[model samples]
Target chain A: MEKLKYALFTGCTAKQSTPEQMMSTMAVANKLGIELVELTEASCCGASHLQDYDDFLSLVLNARNIAYAEKHGLTMVTICNTCQLNTAMTKHRLDNNEELKAKVNEKLAEVGLEYKGTSPVTHFLYAIIDDFGLDKLKEMVVTPLSQFNIAPFYGCHNIRPSELQNETHKSAENPYNPTSLDDLIIACGGMNVDYDEKNKCCGFHAELQSPHTAAALTGNAIAGAMDNNADWMVTPCPLCHLKLDTQADHASEAIGREVELPVLHMQQMVGLALGCTPAELGLKHHVTKVDFV
Target chain B: MSTEHKITTQNVNFKVFRFNADEDYLPYYEDYNMEVTSEEVVLDILNRIKWDHDGSFSYRRSCRHGICGACAIKVNGRSTLACKESMNDMIDLFGNELTIEPLSKKRAIKDMIIDKADFWDKHAAVQPYLVAEIDEAPTSENLVSPEEENALDDADLCIQCGACHYACPAVEHNEDFFGPAAFAAAYRFSADVRDHSETRLADVNEEKQGVWDCVKCFECAEACPKEINPIGKITKLHQMAFQEGIAKNNVAVRHAVGFKKSIVKNGVLDEGGLVLYSEGPAIVKHIPVALKMFSKGKIVPPWGITKSENLDEIKKLVKSSSTAKF
Candidate 1:
C-alpha cells in the first residue's frame, strides 16, 4: 500500500505487441504512487507452447520469470492472463516442494541465478483492485463512465484452477460469475452490465491453428455483449483485447453481422477515468476506435 | 404471519437451440417468452415451451432436480444443467434473455439434445468401475476409512454430467482428449483404494489424447455444476502418472520440457533446437506451420544462437531442476 513497487513482467504478447496495456498499466500504477519496475531478460511464460513440450520446462520458464523479480527483490506483476497463470502455477509448485526448489535452484545457479522463492506473481487486475482500493480508485476518477454500459470480460486463465489464487484472488467465488472487473467499472462510474458470454473465451489461442473456429468464438462473445446493449467492453487479457478489437472485422464476417463493437483494456479504462488522453493511454495505437473511452 | 410480496416474472425469454435430424436444415435459435414463475428452473421454461409454445419442440430431461444431469446444455455458451441453474440466478447475472444451445464440442441431435456416444466412450475408456487393487478379494465389504472417504469425498458427487467435457478447450481442439468429466471419473476410481491403477494410469498417458493435452484452461472446474473441480482431478492424474512411471515420448511432454532447456541455454526459446530436440523426426511435417508463423513475425531468426543476458543463471536453473530425460 505504501508506494508498492513491482517488477512488471509484461509477457511477450503485451511487451512485443500490446504496448498500450503496459504503458497504461504503468501510468495508472504511477498515478496511484506505485512504481512499475521492469522485469527484463525473462523468457516467455510458455502459454500453450511450452506446455506442449514438457510440463517441467514450463515450470522452469515460469520460475525463470519469477527469478527475475526475485533478483530485484520485488513481486512480479503481469497484465497477460496466460503469463499470470503459468507463473502463479510455477510459484505454487515450487512453494510446496523444497526438493523441486533445490533442483530448480541448482539449474538456476549455473546462470548465476538462484530461485530464492521470494516473489509472488500478481495479475495487474488484482494488483490494482487490492493495492489501489476501490475507494481510492473512485476518488482518483476525473471522468465518470456511467453513460457507457461496459461488459467486463474476465477471460479463462487469470481467475481459475484454484492453485493460482493468491491473497487478492479467491477461487471460492464461482469462476463463471466474474465480478472483479465490475469493481473497476463501478469505480470509474461506469455501468458494469452483464452479458451472456461474460466469461466465454475469446478464442485467441484457438485462432493460431483454426482462424474460422476462433472467429466464430470471438463473434459469439461480441454478439452476446451486443445483445445486452453494451456500449463497449473491457477485458483484462491482451489476447482477448486482440480478438475482441483487431479481429472484429473477421468476427463480424463469421457471425454474418457488423461486429464493430469496441473493446478496451482494464488499464485503458482506468486511464480514461484518471483523465489520461488517447495518446497518453495509447488508444490511438489500437485497432478499435476511441469512441467510448 | 408474514406480509410478503407476490413472486412475478418480468418478460423472461428463452432462446433454445432447435435442431431436428429428421429435417434437412441447419440448427437455429427459436425464442419463446414465458409467463410468471418466480422460482422456475431453465428446464421448467423449456417444458413450458414444449407444452404451450410448440408440441414439436423436443429436448431431454429425466429429473426436475439436478441429479440426473440429463438437461445439460450451453446456457450462454457455458455447459450447464437447466434443472440445476435457477431463473432467479440467471436473471441476476444475465437478465431475462437466455440463450441455450446443445453443448459445444458435441453434435446436436435434435433441439437441445446432443449425441452422448463419444462422451460415454471417453468416460468408459477411463475405466470408471472399481475393483480391488490386489488379486485377493476382500473378505467383507471393503469399507473405506472416514479419512480416506474424506479424501475422495468431492469425487463422490460426480453425476456423470458431461458439462466439463463441453466446457474444456482441450476437448474442443482434440476429440480424443480424455476430457474433464472423464478425468474426474477416472480419479474417483483410482483414489478408491480398491481400484487397480496400473491400467487406469496407462489410460491417462494416452499420446496427446490424455492429461497432457489439457491447457489448464480451468473452464472445466468453472462450468462444473456439482462443484466437482475436474481440473483438480486432472492435476492429481498428472501426479499419479508421474509416480507410476507411465511415460511416453509425446509432443506435450517433449515440448514442455525442451522449451525450458532451450530457454536455459538461450535467453528465449531456441527455435531451431526446440523443433530438432522436441519434434525430432516430426519437425519436417510441421515446417509449413512454422513458415506461416515465421511470415507473421511470430517466430524471428538468429534461431538458437541468441544468447540471454543471464547465461549463468539460465544454465543453473536448467541443470539443477529434477527433469526426467525421456
Candidate 2:
C-alpha cells in the first residue's frame, strides 16, 4: 500500500494540555506507516468560540489554516473534534460560495496565504479507519486487547452535521451513533459494548461556563457506564477525555452514585495495541487509575 | 444499525433525570422499563411512566401535540419536543436504548420537569409581542404584504418551545447573552414591517450581553424541533445591529482582524499579538492573566515567522474581501 501522509493539525487542547496524546499518536502513526507533517505554524481552527462571534472572521481564520495544508499538498488531519469540525465547516462554506472564496483568498494574499480548497479536514479517527483501513490496523496490533469491555464516547461536535465530513466517512459513520472508534477498538482486539451513555457529550467545553451542569452531564455518562458495567471509556477528543477522566470522582458524587471509570484516547489505545505498556502510554497522568492496563 | 432500524418492544428502558418536589437533593437518574412500542412517540412513553410506573413523577404537558411546546425534555442530550419526536426515529439514530433528562441550561424541579420560570423570563426579556410604529390605530383589519409575511414565516413557526434556549452554548456559558429562542423572537419583531420601533428593539443587542456573545456552535439549530435555525436569525440580528450602528465596540471586528493578521504574518495565531489587537488598550487588564498562563507553561513563545513569500498571497486574500481589512 502507498504510504499515508497528511498535515497534522494539533489544536490548543492537544498542543498545550495533552502533549502525551500527540507523542502516543506519533508512536502509533510510525508503527502504522502513516506520515504526520505537523503544521507547527497553524493557529486555532476558529472553533465556535471564535466563529459564533463573527462568521466571516472565523471563515477566513480557518481558511488560512487550511491554506497552509493546501500549500504543502496535504489534507488537514485534526485530533480535536472541535478543530476538525471547525475546519471542515469553513471548507464547506468556502466550497459553496465563490464570493467568499475570492475574498478569503484576497485576505490570504495579504500575508501570502492562498487556498485552492483541495485539502479536506479529516478527524484522526477517520485517519486511522478510512485512511488506514482497520484490516491494516489489525495486522499491526502486537497485542490484542481482548475482552476489554470499552464504551466508546463519540463527542458531540465530532460526527453530527454530516455536511462537514467526507462522503465516505459520512456513510461509514452514523451521526447519531458513530462507530469509527468502535471499529478501531475492535481492530485492537477490544470488545465494544452498547450502553445508554455510549454516544453523548462529556460536556467538557461547559466546565468553564457551568461547572455543575458539566459535572452532571459527565456524571450521567459515568452512571450509564456503571449501569452497563463498562471497564473503560475511550474517546477521540482530548476535551472529552479530560472531563470523563478527571471529573469521574466528582461526577460520581454529582450524579448521586458510586461511579469510577477510566478514560483513554484512541492513540493511547493504539499505543497499547502496538504493545506499549500503561506506563509507556502515559496512563499514570490520567486522573482515574487504569490499573487493569 | 441503518436508518431503517426500529425498536420493537413492549418494555423499552427509559433512563430519566429525576428530582423531588421538595427540592431536597441532588438530581439522579431513575430507570423505568415502560410497556411501550416503537410506534409511540416519546410523549407516550413519558405519560405511561408518569401514570403507571410512578404517579409522583411530575412533568408539564398540554395540547398533547407539538403546539404547546410544554413537554420539552432532553432526549439523550438533545432538547427535543417530546410530543413530536418518534421512538423509531430515535432508534434509527441511536440504538434501542433511550436516555431522557431534564432540559439543560435550567433548574430541575422534578422528574423531566425543569423550571421554565427562567425560560419564560428570557422570553419576556425580548418583548415577544409586537408594537406597530404607526401612531394611528388601523380602522380596518391589519394586512401585511406577501413579501413581509414570507419574511415572518420562519420566525412564526416558533411554538414558544425552549428547546433552542436549552441547546444554546451562549445561554449555558454567558449569563448575560440573550439565547437563541429569545433572539429568534427578537428577530421576528425586528423583521416585521409594521413594527416601527425596530431601531430601539435592535438596540438590545448592542452590548456584550447580546448577539455578539454567541459562540455559534449551532446546537440550537440541531435541537429545534421546528427547524427555526434560531442561530441563523441571531446572525441576522448581528447584521442588523451592525447596519443600525447599534454595535459600538470594535471587539469582535478587532478579534476577527487580529485573527487573520496573525495567520498572514506568522502562518499561525500570535496570541500575544492577537490580544494586543483584539483587546487594544484593555490588554493592560489581562497582563496578569498572561503572566498566570505563562507560569503555567500554557504560553509558549511564538516559533517566530516562517517564510513571508507566501504572505503576499495572504495579503492578496485579505485585500479581496468585501469588508475586512488586514
Candidate 3:
C-alpha cells in the first residue's frame, strides 16, 4: 500500500456540530501516515442549503470551494457527505457547462480563485479504502474492537448517482445498498450487524421541513440497531450522525423506551483504537455516549 | 449525565405550523401544550390541540390506525402519519419541545391537510387500477404465496398520503418526476401476480410522469407508515423496466443499465462511457436546456475512468451473490 496526502475540507457542520468526526478522522490519518492538510480558508460547500434554497447560489458556493481545492494542487477529501456530493455534483456541472464555468470563474475571480475542474472530491472513507488499501488498514489496529457490534449507516451523499460519486470508489454495487461500510468496520476491528433496513437514510431533508417523520425514521434505525444488539451505530457521514444522535433522545421519547444507542462517525472509532481519548475528539458532546471499548 | 430511568409525565409543547391562505402573511408557528399518555399517537395529541386549544386549528384524519394515511404530517422534520408515531418517540428524539407542521413543499389546504388533488391527478396519469386482461370473475379466489404477497405488500399498503411525494427531493425539483407515492402505486399494480395484463408495464411506461424520474432517495420508504418498502419497489420497477425492454424513455433506466454494464465490464460505474452511451446524441436534444446548467458549471467529465485493481474480486462477489440468489 502507498501513502497519500490530501487537503482536508471540513465543511461547515463538522466545525460546529460534529467536530469530533473531523478530529478523529485526522487522528487516524496521522496514525496511518496519511497526510491530511487542512484548508483553513475553505468556505462552506453550501451543504443542503444551496440545494434547497437557491440552485444558483449553491453552484457558485460549491464552485468557489472546488476552485480553492484546485488552487492548492491537492485533491479534496470531505467528512460531510453532503459537502462531498455538493462539490462533486458542482464539479460535474462545472466541467460540462462552459457558460456556467465562465460565470462561476467570474465569481471565483472575485475571491482570487479559478475553476479548472481537475481535482476530485471524495469522502474520507473512500480515501482509506482506495489510497491506504484495506489490507494495510486491517494490519494497523492496536486494540481489537471485537466486543462492539456496529451498524454502518452510509448516508445519501457518499453513494448516489454515478455523476455524484465515482461508484468504483464506493463500496455498494447497487447504489442504494452498499456493503462497503461492513467491510471497513470489520477491518477496524468491529462486528458488523446486518439489519434489514441498514441502507436507509435518516431523513435529513425531511428534518428541515417535516421533523416528525424524520424522528420516526431516525428512531426506526436506532431501534433496529438496538434490536440487532448493536453497541454503537457507526456512520460515515456527519449529517446522519447529527440527525440520528441528536434526535435519538426524541426517538426514545416517541417510542416510549430509552433508545440510548449512541451514533459515532467511523473515524472516531478508529481514533479510539489509535489510542486517542474521547475528550480530544469531542465525543462528550454527543447525545449518547458510547461506553464500550 | 443523569441516568434517570423515570419517564417524565408532563404536558409536551407543540409548536405547530399554522396556515390560512386568506391571510397576508405566510404560515407560521402557533404553540400548544398538551398532555400525553404512553400510547397516544401523534394524531391523538393533534386532535387534543384542535379540540381544546383552538377550534380554528383544523387538520384531516380518518382511520386512526394508520390505514387511511390521511393524518400524515411533518413531526420534527421527517414525514409520517400522525396516527402511527407515538408521543413517547417524539420526546425522546427531539425533546419535549416539538414542532408540528403540515408537509412543506406542498400547497397547504388549511392546516395540516395538503391539496393532494395534483398528486391524485398525476397518479391517475399512471393509471393505477388493475389492468387485468381476464374474463373470468373467479373460480374460487386468486390466492398468492406468502413470499409473493410479501414482495408486493409494501407497494400495496401505501394509502396515497403524499408524505413521500412531499419528502422527495427529485419530485420537488422536477415536477416531471412521477413522485415517490405514484411510483410505488405503479409498482403495486404492476407487480401484482394476479394481474397478467401485458399492457401493465406499457401503461406505466407510456406516462411522461413515471418511475424513470426518481432520484432514488429512499425518502418514500422512510416516510411509509406501514413499513412498505417503497425504495425496494422502485428498484423492482427499474428491474422490470430492463427485463421488459421498456428502458428506452427512462432516465433511471440508463443508470441501472449503466450499472449492469459497468459491473459486467469494469465492476464499477464508468462515468465517461455511461454518459456517452446512456444519454448520447438523442439526449443531445435535451443538452440545449442542460447547457444553461453547463454554463452554470453543473456538468463535467467524470474525474477518472481508471478501473479499481480489485475489479475481479467485485465481479466475483457479484457473481457469487447472484448465484446465491439463484
Candidate 4:
C-alpha cells in the first residue's frame, strides 16, 4: 500500500477549545501509518464567521490555506467541519470562477503565495473512508469497540450544503441519510445507534446569538442520541464536540434533566479501537469524563 | 397510454403521519401498502391513498407540478415537493419502504398537512413585496437592469413552499427566528435595485430573531425544491448589513468582525478575545464556563499562545482583500 500523507488543517477548536481532538487525531494517524504534515503556517479557515463579515477576505484566507497544501503537493485534511466547508467552498469557487481566481491570486501574489487550485480539501472523516479503506481499518483494529453503542453526529458542515461536498468528494455521503460515520462506527466494531438529530446542527454558530436556543439545540441532539440508547456520542467536528461536551450542563437545563452523555472526537473513537490508552488519546481533557474508557 | 413506455410496478410501504387536531391528542403513523408505477411521483401515491384507500387522508396539493409549492412534505426525512419527487428517484434513494411525514418544525393539521399560519406570518414580517417609490402606475417597461435581474435569479425562484423554512434548525430551536423563506423573501425585495425600501434591512436586523439567528447549517439550501439557496441569501443579508452600516453594535456582527481582526493580527482566531470582544461586559456570564475549561486544560492564556509564522503574509492578504469586492 502507498503511504497516506496529508496537510493536516486543525481548525481553531481542536487547537484551542478542544485540544484533545488534535491529540487523538495525531495518535490515530501514527498508529495507522499516515504521515500528517501540520499546516502550521496556514491561518484559520475563517470558520464561517469571517465569511459573514467579509466574504472576499474569507475567500483569500482559505485560498492561502489551500495554497500551503499546493506547496506541499498534498491534499488538505481538516478535522473541523466548518474549516472543511469554508476551505472547500473557496477551492470550488476559485476553480470554477476565472475572475474570482484572478482576484484571489492577485492577493496571494502579494503574500508570496499563489493559489493554483491544485489542492482538494476534505474532512478527516472522509479521508479515513476514502483514502484509508474501511476494510483495512477493520483489519488494524486491535481492541474492537464491540461493547459500546455509539451515535455518529454528522454535524452540518461535514455533509450539508451538498453542492460543494459533492464537488469535493466523488462518493460524498448523502446529506439526507449520511452513513459514513455509521460505517466508521461499524468498522471499529461498535454498534450504530440511529437517531433523528444525528445529522443536525450542534448550535455552535448560534452560541453568541441566542444562548438559550444554542443550548436547546445542543440538548436536543444529545437527548435524541441518549433517548435512542446510545452509550456515547461521537462527532467529526471539534466545534460540535466542544458544544456537546462543554455546554452539556447548560444543555441539560434546556432539556430539564441532568444529561451527561460523553462525547468523543471521531479520531478518539478510532484511537480506542486501535488499542490506544484513554490518557494517550487525551480523554482526560474532556469536560464530560470518559468513564467508559 | 403509450405502449413504447415500459410499465414497471413495485409494492411500496408508505407510513404516513396521521393526526387530526379536533380528534387525536397524539399523532401516529398509518401504513398504506400499494403497488405504484415506476413513472409516478409522490403526489400520485398520495392521491391514490386519499382516493382509493381512505377518503379522510388529507394533504395539500395544486398545479400538480413543482410550482405553487403546496405539495411540500417530508419524504424519507427530507423536505421536498411531493409533486416534483419522482417515484423511481425516491425508491433509489430510499428503499420501497418510505415513511412520509409533515414538514418538520410545523404543527400537523392532518396527515401530511402542516399548519402554515406561523410560516406565512413570519413571511409577512419581512414584507415580501416590492416597495418601489413610484409616483404613478408605470407603463409597460423593464424597470430593472439585466445585471440586476440576473442577481435576483435564486431569490425569485422561491415558490413559498415553506420547505426551507421548516427544514431550518434555527426555527426548530427558536420561534423568533424569521425562518429561511422569510430571509429569502427579504433578500428578494431588499436586493432589488428598483425597490427603495429603507426599512427592509432594518426589519430583518433584529438582534436574535433576524439574520444573525441563522445557524449556517445549509439545510435550507438542501430542502428547497427550487434550489433557492436561502442560506446563501441570508449570508448576503449579513454582508448587506455590514455594507449598509446596519446593526454595527449587534453581538453577532461584533463576533463576525472579531474573526477578521483576529485573522489579520495573528493569522488565527483569538477565541478568548473573540468572546470578550463580542460579548463585551456580557463576558462576565461566561466566567464559570471559562474557568471550567481552564481547569480542564482546554484553554490557555492569550500571552502563552504562539502567533502564526506567516503573519506578515496574512496581514498583507487581509489588507489587499479589504479593498476588493466579493
Candidate 5:
C-alpha cells in the first residue's frame, strides 16, 4: 500500500464560493491516507474570462501557472473542471506548439519563470480513484448512507475532450462510464440510483450572464432528482454545487414542487460516511442544508 | 401506451447500467435481450425493460414530441432525443447490439435520459425571448414585413438540445462562451425590426460570453436538429456588432477594424501592417507564444507583405454594404 500525495491546486472557487468542498476533499484525502501540499501563491486559474475573451492573454496566464507547477516537481490536482481544462489545455498547447512555448519562455525569463512542461495535471477524482484504491475506501467507511437515494452529476470536465487528460484516460469521456465516486457512495452505505439529467450543466455561466437560463438548467436537475425520489444529489464539481444549491428557489418555482434538494460535493459525502463531523467536512457553507451525523 | 399507436417488435440487446439496493454500486452492463419494433422509440423500449425485464432500471422522458427536449441521449456516438429517434434507425445502423447511454457532457440520469437543463441558463443569459418596442398599438401583429421578419428565420429554429455546444471546439476551451444557442437566440432578438437593436447590442456586448467567443467552427450548424444555421446567425451578429462598434472586445474585431483601416488607407488589406495595427503594442505578448513557431521557422515577420490593390473597391463594398443589415 503506497501512500499517494498531490500538489493540490484548489483554484478560486474553493477559496471563495465553495470552501466546504475543499475542506471535504482535504478530509477525504486524510482519511484515505493521501498527502496534499497546497499551492498557496497560486493566483486565479485565470477563471473562464481570459480563455473566451483573450486568446494570447489566456496562453500567457496559464503558461505562468504551468511553469510554477513544473518548477515544484509535482503533478497539479485541480478541484474546478474549468481550471483543469485551462491548465491542461495550456500544457497540451505548450507541448504541441514549440514557437508559442519559446515566446512564452522568453516572457517567463523576464519574470524568473521557465516552463519545461514536465508536470501532468489530474482532477481530484482521478487521484481518489487511481491512487486510493477501492479497498482503502471501503475500509474508511464508518456509516453506510443506506437511507439516501442519490443521483451522481459528472458536470462537463470530468468527461469530454479526451485531449484534456490525454489518451490513456479516454475511457473516462463517457459520463455513464463508471468511476470510483459511485463505488465510494454505495460503499458508504448510501444508495446510488439511476438519475435522468445527471450529466447536465448547472448553468455556471448563466449565473453571470443570464439568471433565468441558469435557474431553468439548475431547476431541471433539481426536478429530475425529485422525480427520481432522490433524497439529495451528489456531484464532484463545486461549481455545479454553487448553481444547484443556490438556484433551489428558482428550480422549486419551475417544477411546481418544493424541490429543496441539497447538493453534497462527493468529497463531503465521502467524508461524512468516513465518520468526519460536519465542521470537519465544511458542510456549513453549502447553500442547501444537509442533515449530517 | 397510446391506443392510437401501432407497435411492432424485434429482439435486441441493451447493455444497461444497473443499481442494486443492497449490493455495491458496480455499474455492470446487463444484456436485456428483448424485442422492439421499428415504430417504437428508445423510450418505449426502456419502459418495456423496466416493466417486464428489470423493475429498477430508472430513466426519464416526457412530451415524447421532441418539443420538451427531455428525451435527449446518445444512440451511437451522436446525440438525439429518445422519443424522437426511432428504433428503426438503430436497426439500420448498429442492429441488435445497440449501446444506448445518456448524452455526453452530462451526468447520466439513468438508462438514456441525461440532465440537459444546462443550456437553459445559456438561453436565458442570451435573453431568448422576443423584446420589441412599440409605443403605439401595432395595426397588425407587430407589423413585420415579410422581408424583415424572414431576415433571421434561419436563426429562429434552435430547440436548445445542446448537442452543438458540446461538440464545439471553442466552447470546450472557453467556459464563459455562450456557445451557438445563445448567439443564435441573440440574433433572433437582434434581427427583429421592432426590437431595440442598440439596447440589445449593449446587452450582447457587455460580456466576454456573447457572440465574440465563437471561433466559426460551424459544428453547431451540423448538430442542429432544426434546420436553423446557428453559425450563419453568429456571423451576421458579428457583422452587426462590428459595424455598430458594439463588438469591441472581440479578438476578431481587432482584425476587422484593422482591415477596415487598411482598406481605407492602402486601398486593400496591408497584410503585414494589418497584424501589427490590429495587435499594436500587445504584439509583444506574442513573443512568448511565438517561440515554438520561431524555433520551427514558422514565425513569419509581420512586414514586407504585399498589400491588396483593391482597397477602393473594398471601401466601396463596405460603404454600400452598410445599408443592408445582416
Candidate 6:
C-alpha cells in the first residue's frame, strides 16, 4: 500500500483560536501514516464573512488557495467546514464556468499562479471515510471510546447547499441526517448519542453579528445533546468547536442552567482512540475541561 | 388498445403531525399505513389520508402544480412542497417511513398548517412591493435591461412558500430575524432598476435581526424548491448596505470590515484583534474568556502571530479584485 498524502488547509480558527484542532489533526495523521503537506502560503478562505463583504476578493483568494494545491498535485483537505465550502464552491464555479475561471485565472496570473481545478477540496471527516476506510480505522483503535456517549455536530457549511458539497466530494453525506461523523464515532467504538440538533448550525458565523442569538443557538444544540445523555460533543469544523467550547457562559444563560460540555475536534476524538495522550492532542487547551479522559 | 406501464407499490408509514390549538395542548404524531406507488406525489398521499383514512386530516393546498406553493410542509425532516416532491424520490432518500409536519412547530396552528402571520409580517417589514418614485406613476412599460433582470436570478420565481423561512435556523432561534424569504423579496424589489426605493437597503440593515443575523448556514438555500438561493440574495443585501453606506457603524458591518482588513493586511485572521475591532469597548465583556483562552494557549498576542509568507500577494489580490470599500 502507498501513502495517502494531502495538502492540509488549516483555516484560521484551527491555527489561531483553536490550536488544539491543528495539534490533534497532526497527531492523528501521523498515527495513520498519512502524509499531510501544510499549505503555509495559503491565506484565509474568507470565512463566509469576507465573501459577503467582497465576493470577487473571496473568489480570487480561494482560487489562489486551490491553485497552490493544484501546484502540489494533491487533494486539498480542510479541517474547517467553512473553508471546505468556500474552496469547494470556488472550485465548482471555476470548473463549471469557463468565463468565471478565466476571470479568476487572470487574477491568479498576477500572483504567478493558475487554478487548473485538478485538486478536489474535501473536509477531513469525508476524507477519513473516503480515503482512509473506516474498517482500517477500526483496526488501529487501541482504546475504544465505548464508555462515553459522543454527540456528533455536523456543522452547516460542510453539509447544506448540497449543490457545492456533492460536486466536490465523492460521497456527500445526506444533509438532512449526516452520518459520517456518527459512522466515524462508531468506527472508534464509541456510542453515538442521537439528538435533533446533530445536523444543525452552531451559530458560529453569526457570533459577531448577534452574540445573544448565537449563544441561544449554541445553547440549544448543546442542551439537545446533553438531554440525550451525551458525555461530550465532537465536531469536524473548528468554528463550531470554538463556539461550542468558548460560549459556555452565554450558552448557560440561554439554557437557563450551568452548561459545561467538553467539545472535541474530530481529530482529537480519533486521536483518543488511536492511543494519543491528552497532552499530545492538546485537550488541556480546551476551555471546557475534558474530564472524560 | 392501451399501452401498459409498470407501477411499483411499497408499504410506507406516514407519521403526520396532529395538533389543534382549540383542543390539543401539545402536538402529537398519528401514524397512517398505506401502500403507495411511484406515480404518487406527497400531496397525493396526504389527500388519500384525508379522503380515506381520516376526513379530518387537515393541510393547505392550492394549485396542485408546484407554482402556488401552498402545500409546502415538512417531509421526512426537510421542508418541501408536497405537490412537487415525488413519492419515489422521498423513499429513495429517506426509506419507508416519512414524518410529515407543519412548516414550523412553534407556529403550528393545526396538522400540517402553520400560522404564517409572522412570515407575512417580516415580508411586509421588508416592504416587499414595487415602490417606484412617488411622482412617477408608470404611464408606459418601464424598461429594464436584460442584465438588470438577470441579476435578480431566480429570485422572481419565489412563490413566498415560507419553506426557506421555516428552514432557516436563524429565524427558528431568533424571532426578530427577517428570514431568507423576506430578504430575497427585499432584494427582488430593491435591486430592481424600475423600483426606486431609497430606504430598502436601510430597512434590512438592522444589527441583530436583519441581513447580518444570517449565519450563512445555507439551510434556506437547501430548502428553496425553486433554486432561489436566498443566502446569495442576503449577501447581496449586505454588499448593497456597504456600497450605499447604509448602517456603516453597525457592529456586523464593523466586524465584517475588521475581518477583511485583518485578512488583507496579514493574509490571515487575527482573532484577538478582531474581537476588539468588532466589539470596540464591549470587548471588556469578553475579558474573562480572553484571559482564559490566553492562559490555555488557545490564543496569542498580535505580535506573537506570524504573518502569511505571501502577504504581498494577498494585498495585491485584495487591491485588484475588491472595489467595495470596507
Worst 10 residues of 4 chain A by lDDT: A167-176
TM-score of 4: 0.97
Question: Where in model 6 is the C-alpha error above 4 Å?
Answer: B1-5, B134-141
For DockQ, the strongest prediction is: 4
For candidate 5, the lDDT comes to 0.64
Lowest-sum lDDT 10-residue window in model 4 chain B: B317-326
CA lDDT of A224 in candidate 2? 82
**Per DockQ, what order, best first?**
4, 6, 1, 2, 3, 5
The residue ranges of model 5 lying beyond 4 angstroms of the native Cα positions read A162-171, A176-180, A254-256, B1-245, B248-326
Candidate 4's residue-wise lDDT over B43-64, tens digit each? 9989998999889999999998
Candidate 1 C-alpha lDDT tens digits along B1-326: 39876787768777777888788378777887776467778788878888988898877899777898888887767677889887788777666787878785247778877788888999989888885555476577767888887777498798977888887766775677778899888889888876765688777767646776665667888788898988778766765665566656655456555656666666555555665776678677656545543443334444424365666655665566544444
Better of 4 and 6 by DockQ: 4
Q: Which structure is stronger by lDDT: 1 or 6?
A: 6
Q: List the TM values for chain B, per candidate.
A: 0.80, 0.80, 0.80, 0.94, 0.74, 0.95
User: For model 3, what is the C-alpha lDDT against the true structure?
Assistant: 0.67
C-alpha displacement of A48 in model 1, angstroms? 4.9
DockQ scores of all models, one per candidate:
0.23, 0.20, 0.03, 0.78, 0.01, 0.75
lDDT of model 1 at position A112: 63
Local accuracy of candidate 5 as per-residue lDDT tens digits, A1-293: 76687787777556545667778888888888888877654544444433333344455656666666777788778887767766787788788999989976766665566778887887877666666666677777887788889777777655544334444242354443434456667777888766656755666643333444555667777888788888888887777887787667766664466777878888888888888888988766665667634
Tens digit of per-residue lDDT, candidate 4, span A39-129: 9998988888888878898998899989999999999999999998999889988899999999988888886889998888888888999
Interface RMSD of candidate number 6: 1.2
Model 6 over residues A1-293: C-alpha lDDT tens digits? 58999999988878788889989999999999999999998888888888777787889999999888999999999999999988888888889999999998898899899999899888888888988899999999999999999999999988988888877777867888778899999999999999999988888888877777788889988999999999999999899998999888888897688777899999999999999999989998898899878
* Interface RMSD of the candidates, in order: 5.1, 5.5, 17.5, 1.3, 17.9, 1.2
- Summarize candidate 6's per-residue lDDT along B79-177 as a digit string, tens digits: 899999999999988899989999998788879888999999999998888987644665777678899999887788999989999999888878999
Error of 4 at A246 (Å): 0.5
| Regions of candidate 3 where Cα sits further than 4 Å from its true position | A1-28, A31-293, B1-8, B23-25, B134-141, B249-252, B282-306, B310-326
User: Estimated TM-score per prediction?
Assistant: 0.68, 0.72, 0.53, 0.97, 0.57, 0.97
